[model samples]
Target chain A: MKLHVHIKKKISEFSLAVDLEMTDGLLSLLGPSGCGKTMTLKCIAGIENPDEGFIKLGDRVLFDSRKKICLPPQKRRVGYMFQDYALFPHMTVRQNVLAGMGRRPDPASADPFLERFRIADLHDRLPEELSGGQKQRVAMARIAAQDPDVILMDEPFSAMDTMLKWELEQEMLETLSEAEKPVLFVSHDLDEVYRMGGNICCMKDGKTGNIISNEEFFEDLKNGNSELLPGWRILPPER
Target chain B: MNDMVNFLSGLDWSPLFISLKTGVVATVISFFLGIFAARKVVKASPGVRAVADGILTLPMVLPPTVAGFFLLLIFSARRPLGSALYTSFGIKVVQTWLGCIIAATVIAFPLMYRNARAAFEQVDVNLVYAARTLGMSETRIFWRVIMPCAAPGIVSGTILTFARALGEYGATAMLAGNIPGKTGTISQKIAMVIQNGDYRTAGFWVAVILIIAFLIILLMNVVTARHMKNIHRY
Candidate 1:
């Protein structure tokens, strides 16, 4: 699958202009805070409307300013995993997953996703009863149950501690590998970008700078190229 | 003590029933209307939201007698809305039980609206965006996600609204009037007995009102504590 996006939006302090093209596999949008990484994901998900330009996923035109066609998020079939997980506080794990099934949600149909995410036992428990890691699993499970065309995640592990972040990242890597959908992950941490192991789109000051493979990113780092770094000065790799 | 018992036992219990009926009906009407208005106002532009909020909350800020006067102007049988209602549906608001409900609802509605609005605003907006991406409709998200998250504030609002409606005196007195068994609430009953120099009956009614108010507040605290426990569970 291929996803193409070109969009511009102006907030009070900065104007976001992002153009990205991705093929099937994991892709990371690495940037500092307020560099428009999350805004790009929001635009692709159809949550935030762009001032100009078009977004296309495969054959479907999700948004086109020239055509005056902007599909709502529901019609776009794009799974968005929020940083906070955003699990419905009132719903149990099973019901939360079922809510993502759209119009005629069947409880039994969500069972496979629940089991796949290893949240089968937690089905009857509300979101308030779950741990942070479990909440993330449920969020992923809910998205998986939807079976969307593309997945956009905005700083999914930023809330967790280092230990939990590592554990959840390993879990997420496994899950994303098995899903085989085009995934766009946004993060501010360079270590997370490297650990995610994908093509990296470096963004700075609300603009996309470069699209490089993970290998090229590491090579650039080793070669002491500071252009890829946004605000922070380039430092030697800890490893 | 005997005098107090005699006074309580011989009291016209219709005021108790009338007050509860009026409070329940008014609270129910304000509950839905307040939440709906709050949601709409919250989504409006800042200027429109401020205007709407000011208009809605005017009754709560103003004296109840002023609210009563406005109600009378709108529903006084000779007025346009009052005449239209009476002519079409035979519904009368002037000095009727319906007037009591209308007055109580108008006076108590702002509490629910303000509380629900604050609660809705305090909710994590990302949760709404996430729900939208999950293909949940707006209505579904409001009920399933937003309502549950705002329960504590809404519950407290409901309690305050019920209490205010139950104890409505100035507005109910002016709009509904103290008509023996029809529109006479506990507060009106107390006032009526006190004016007639019957301190014993007025004291009993005051005690009853205090007990009811305390119970409502207690219920709210219990629900709030339970909500806190749920939050801590995660």
Candidate 2:
């Protein structure tokens, strides 16, 4: 699927003007904190409105300022995995997954994602009972059950330990690879962006700077030319 | 010991019942209205929120007598609202059971509203956004997510509201009046007994009131503890 976004929003002391387009792949929007990466995802998810812009995903007009067409988040059908996971603490794992499928969701429909995310045994447990990794799995399971047109992840693993982060990343890659939908992952960590294995859109000062392939990103690191973009840093590869 | 026994045996129990009935009814009305108003005020703009909060909380901050004065101006038989109600529907506000409920609800509503508002504000906004993106409707999110998460604060608000309504005296005296076996509440009864120099009867009622208040507060704490257990421990 194709995703196109050109939006401008002026927040307090920071102006966001982003214009980018991408085809099907895990596109990472790498930026520092408060650099509008999450805001861009929020705009696409319809959580925040842009002062002026148009966003279209595979012929669906999600938002268009000139046309004055802005669909609410519920109508957008975009699966957004929040940074903190945002799981309903009151709901069990099964109920949280089914909550995404609207009322009267077939219980059988959530089972597949539950099993895929390795949360089948924890279905009866509340989010409060789960670990950070387990909660992330439940969040993904909820999104997978929704079966949206695209997925947006905002700092999905920022709170995890090193070992759990790596493991979940591998598991996430396996799950997302089979889905075949455009996934926009936002992160402030360069190592994470590289490990996710997709196109990289380096963002700075609320604007996307360069769109580079994963191979090119590695090549830049190998050639010691990784300092080309601001707010992009290279760290040692994971053990 | 004989006087205490005599007071208990011949106690005018109507005042205790009247006070409880008024408290329960007022608490019920204030519960829903306070939650609704708190939700609205939380979503309003800064300026509008300030104005609305001030107006809603005025009755609580002012002396009950001042609040009674406003109630009188609005519900007095000569006033348009009171005249319309009295002439059209034959519903009287002054010196009526309904007046007790109205007075108690007005005096107790701000406790519920302020507590609920603070609780709603503490909820992580991202949870609401996530629910919306998951295709959950606004109403569903509020009832399923917001309300359950804010249960502890709401419970506290309800307890305070019931306590305040149960003990309401000055406003109730002005609006409902202290008619024995009718509008007289435990607080009014205590005042009347003291005025007649019946210290034994007044002291007996005071002990009963203390016991009831303690029991309710203990019950609420137990309920709140259970609810708190369901919340995530960080």
Candidate 3:
């Protein structure tokens, strides 16, 4: 599936302008902390409204300010994984998964996703009872259960420790790759973005730059073709 | 102590039962209406929210007698609404049990609304956005996620509302009047006995109200404490 977006919004201290298109592959939104990466994802997911322009997912028009057509997040069919996972604290893992299954909510349909994420055993456990890694897995399973057309992940690995991040990163890549849909992953860590091995969309001060392959992104940084941005830190791998 | 039991055995206990019934009915109504009003205000524009909040909370700050005056004006039988209800439904709010409930609900609604609003505001915004993106309807998101997360505050609010409703006197006095075994709440009963120079009877009712208030506070603390146990560090 193809996703297209061209939207402009004025936030405090900066104006965000994003225009990009992705078709059936992962694209990492590498940006500084306040560069509006998350805001872009919110606009795509219909959680936030854009001041102008339109957003399209394949043939459907998700939002168009000119026509006054704005679909709410529920109708967008877009999955958003919050930075903190945002699992329902009051619900068990199984119930949380069932929640994403749809309006009617068939409890039995949650089994395969629970099995895929290996959180079947933890289905009865509340979110507060789970570790950060386990919460991430549940969040993934919940999103997968939604069967969204596009998945947007905002700093999915930000909460975990170095040890857990490496292992979960592999699992996330495997699951996301198998989905074969347009995935926009947001992160400020250059190493994490590079490791994801997708086209990188660098954003600085609420403005997005051209989309480039992961290898070329590092090559440009090494050759000093573009100055190193402020907030994109490259950390040495932990031994 | 023997005298106190003797006094209780001879006392007209309808005020206690009436007050409890009024308190419960008012609390139940306030619980849903308060949450609904709070939700609407929270989502409203700034200008609308400020005005709406001020109006909703006015009954709490104003003298209960003033609230009673408005209730009297609106449901005074001479007024259109009062006359229409009396004509069509044969329900008389003035000097009746319904007046007790209406007075208590108006006087106690703000407690529930303010607490519910604060609790809802404290809920993480991302949880709502997450639920929406997961295809859960807005109604489901509210009942499933928001309500559970804000339960402690709601529970405390409910207790406070029930306490306020139980003690409602000024409005109940003006609108419902101190009709023994009908509209006479514990507060009204206490006031009436005190007016007759029956200090002993008034003291007994005062003690009952104090115990009820204390129990309400205890319940608030216990419920909130249990909810906080899993999250509190220090």
Number of the top candidate by TM-score?
2
Question: Tens digit of lDDT per residue, candidate 1, span A1-239?
Answer: 88999888999889999989998889999888988888899999989999999999999999999999999887899999998888887789998899889777778999899899999999999988899999999999999998999999989999999999998999999999888889999998988888889999888888987788999887777666746562434466583
Candidate 2 residue-wise lDDT, B1-234, digit = tens: 896688678877999899999999999999999999999999999999999999999988999999999999999999999999999999999999999999999999999899899889988899999999999899999998899888888988998899999999999999989999889999999999999998878997899899989988997889778877765687
DockQ of each: 0.74, 0.90, 0.86
Candidate 3 runs further than 4 Å off: A227-239, B1-6, B77-91
Best by DockQ: 2
Error of 1 at B226 (Å): 0.6
Q: Look at candidate 3 and give me any clashing residue pairs.
A: none
Off by over 4 Å in 1: A230-239, B1-9, B78-89, B230-234
Name the best candidate (by lDDT): 3
> Cα lDDT of model 2 overall?
0.91
Instruction: After superposing candidate 2 on the true structure, give the runs of residues whose Cα lies further than 4 Å from its correct spot.
Output: A221-239, B1-6, B230-234
lDDT of 2 by residue, A26-76 (tens): 999888898999999999999999999899999999999999999999999
Compute each candidate's TM-score over C-alphas. Answer: 0.94, 0.95, 0.93
Candidate 1, residues B34-108: lDDT per residue as tens digits?
A: 999999999999999999999999999999999999899999999999999999999999889999999999999
Better of 1 and 3 by lDDT: 3
| Model 1: DockQ vs. true structure | 0.74
Fnat per model, in the order given?
A: 0.81, 0.94, 0.96
